[model samples]
Target: MYSAKEAVSANNISEQFISQMTIRYLTSRKLVFPTKSILDEERRINSWLGIGACGSITYGRARIGKTVCMNYVAESIRNQYGSREMVIIWNVTDHPETERNFYASILMAMGYECPRYSTALILKERVLNELILRAHETPFKKAVMFIDEAWKLREKDFYWLMDLYNNLSGKDIQLSVFMYGTRELKDLKHSFKLQGKDQIVGRFMINESQFFGIQDPKELQFCMASVDKLHVCMTDYEILSDGLVDFYFPYADGKTFFDISNDFWEAFQSVRIQKRIAAEDIPMKYFIDSLVICLNMHGKLGNSPIAFPTRKELESCVALSGYGESDDEYTK
Candidate 1:
């Protein structure tokens, strides 16, 4: 009877240990690394908002971190200039197929009281008037509007947007517009070539940044360092080991945690060099997702700690991230 009780207790402890080992303390969503791509976008946005009466477009492959870059830059700008002075309106144009919907979306993001009963033309005027009114205020000096998923914009929507841009600039409202989308934005701009949409085409073409991902070696290193800053830990071990520092959160590579910087960068290079992954194929989002997945996989391996991602595993993560197939290799 005593032996059986001891056996049951041991099994129970084993189950609890497994459960604790599998717990992931970090996620990609929580940590937004300011890589080169993000920094470049930030600079462009700052310049646009700084001068006023201009707009910028950021387009790239799917899951390339364009939206994240925009959000991070906007937040940074807002922080620098208090909330009252710098207003950022974000609208994800998922199904905003009409002009009124676009206006309503912007108004909604700005927290304005938009009546549903109003016509699309009224909504457009309302948004423009609101911007004009804010421009007159002492506290409001700059307003930035971010329209994500802008590839869904139709030809009519382009005219509507151009008109809005013209109206806002005409009022001298100090407005900076940013559109985020996929490569389709380029196709849309091309369509306007002989269609007499020169104004709209010129506005976007003037200040456009193409974000493919981190391609340069130095930039790659910087990205790895940014990942290190996240400092994902084994929370279960932190609690289980009590006050002992040594037993708390062993390195994923079984070495020092900082080794992840080189390990991740090297693994990525190997995959790309072998042609298993292309340079353009590895975007910021996939890299981030792969890192998070690798970290969780390492944490799950109870005693065996493999520090960095294996090529196969990394490739698999990229595949799962929806950017598996190489569309085109980035050229110098």
Candidate 2:
């Protein structure tokens, strides 16, 4: 196994980058902030039973800390539980988003051969058996399943996850499964009872779920402080507490910490890349707007450029962004 540092330095934004970034992102004593409250509840879970399976919900909204909290939890679990423990993050956007593909990934991560078959149900059953076998046969059998962007998962995928837990229950296999995303999973829970709604209302940390909320002001400060040293350059972090954090607090009403932290890091890195600047002297809004221009033009758009946007391209990018025009701003 290569060191995570060496894995990150190598080309490509592989899972290693996600792992590296996750550690840096979550460990940031200052920048990652606190609304998650995830770390606390996770401690109460039983490693063997996965009693506190982080629900398969992302807590989608505007300012919620879904992704940020998951990042923290993933690192914490990795730190606490050794690397031999399985920690796989299945992104719905990047994969086939089907039950079969999902289970195949699980099989692959578990170090068990993925059966060459089309039926997910079969693979799911076989994998559960594998988990049991691995736990009982091995002395240090600790495995964790991490599902990110889980809200986009189809119903079949969700049911199988529940079934996997249900089958593994009462065994000493020691499974720690955490699902993170947005309101998408919460809504699905209305009809499904994997963890059961009673446990939630009754105050028991039932079903391995640790719901999060807006971070506290202290956590906010700590998070900002922590990330400042790890990444290139960042300054003057601001939280739009008034907007989504407050106004949209309900109905999975927050967008999680991804938007804010992503904004901060991208802008910070841009400052480092664009011009030779003193670490202390970062133009906040200039860097932010330029960063946004890159986001608008390069990211989700079709046939976008490979490199990040330039200072000159930003003006036209912004001007064309509102009009739903991509060509005028970032075209060849």
Candidate 3:
């Protein structure tokens, strides 16, 4: 056994060692999915609104890359629409700000320069004016104001949104608003109260996307390959794809890829540092144990609604009696 200091000076250590592995893997280049969904929800949005001044809302479980996806969508919009500088993306969940304050934030994101009025209603109107005024300059004038973590917005906020849509109703200006978050913002419309205002709910034509399930088979293999990249010698094994996919999601549940990477890094580092698992001799037992540790740290063990005995599930046979059934099945 070597002391912490002595281990550093020791030779033949693995190259995967890092001074600080506590940070999220977003900092480690995990956010860039080499291939992304080209048009995340554009087809659907435009399909819903054929004429002009359309709107869309995207919703999904928390930490499932909804924020990142929305950003990608915004970027794509900007790229397609050359004068896309008009589009604004605003985040409104931090510090418990209300819809009014959020309007102020949106105004700020849209380059609101007027210092004349500071009231909520005034700010909202002024923001509309800026967009309206810009649209008159060029027919290509368009803006997609993406409001993130919008579940925090109460029903009262819907008024401001309605006003926004109505204001831009009759102009060459196109306002495509994108709202995303965890709320049953979908279910919010079905409520008896909101039913009274069906027209209001009809404004955005919200679309829902949930990441509550395991990754697709293709994605699972890619995820494992990404993890394999962290290893200098540990090659990616395809034999365990089905097993690992279940393990990862049920363990990390709805976490993003970055979250899973960070989560795995921390758990791996903790187990290796605390018990001093050597670089070369790290066993499969320790690897599984570290994964279990990550599951525990991320607060998601029993949270999984499904379970499996890897031996029985993977090999399709009981392990009892020297895995007698497994042996017989293998022979056949």
lDDT to native, each model: 0.61, 0.46, 0.47
Clash pairs, model 1 backbone: 252-307, 253-307
The CA-based lDDT of model 3 is what? 0.47
Off by over 4 Å in 1: 1-30, 94-97, 112-114, 133-140, 232-254, 273-277, 300-323, 326-332
Report the C-alpha lDDT of model 1 over 1-332, residue by residue, as the tens digit: 11222433644554334333423433334456677778878887787777764676778876667777777887887776666434555656566477778788778877877797999989988888877765565455566677777767677776777787777767665667788887887667667776877887776556777886766667666766554443222323322321111222344335433444555556666655655544543577667666555544544342433534455555554445444445544431
Which candidate has the top score in TM-score? 1
State the local distance difference test value for candidate 1.
Answer: 0.61
lDDT of 3 by residue, 126-243 (tens): 7788778655544566656777876666556667777776778655567777777654655564562456875556676444443221133344334435543331111111021222
Ranking by TM-score: 1, 3, 2
Tens digits of per-residue lDDT for model 2, 273-299: 443332322222232233334443443
Worst 10 residues of 3 by lDDT: 231-240
- State the lDDT at 243 in candidate 1: 14
Off by over 4 Å in 2: 1-58, 62-65, 93-102, 108-122, 133-142, 174-176, 193-217, 231-332
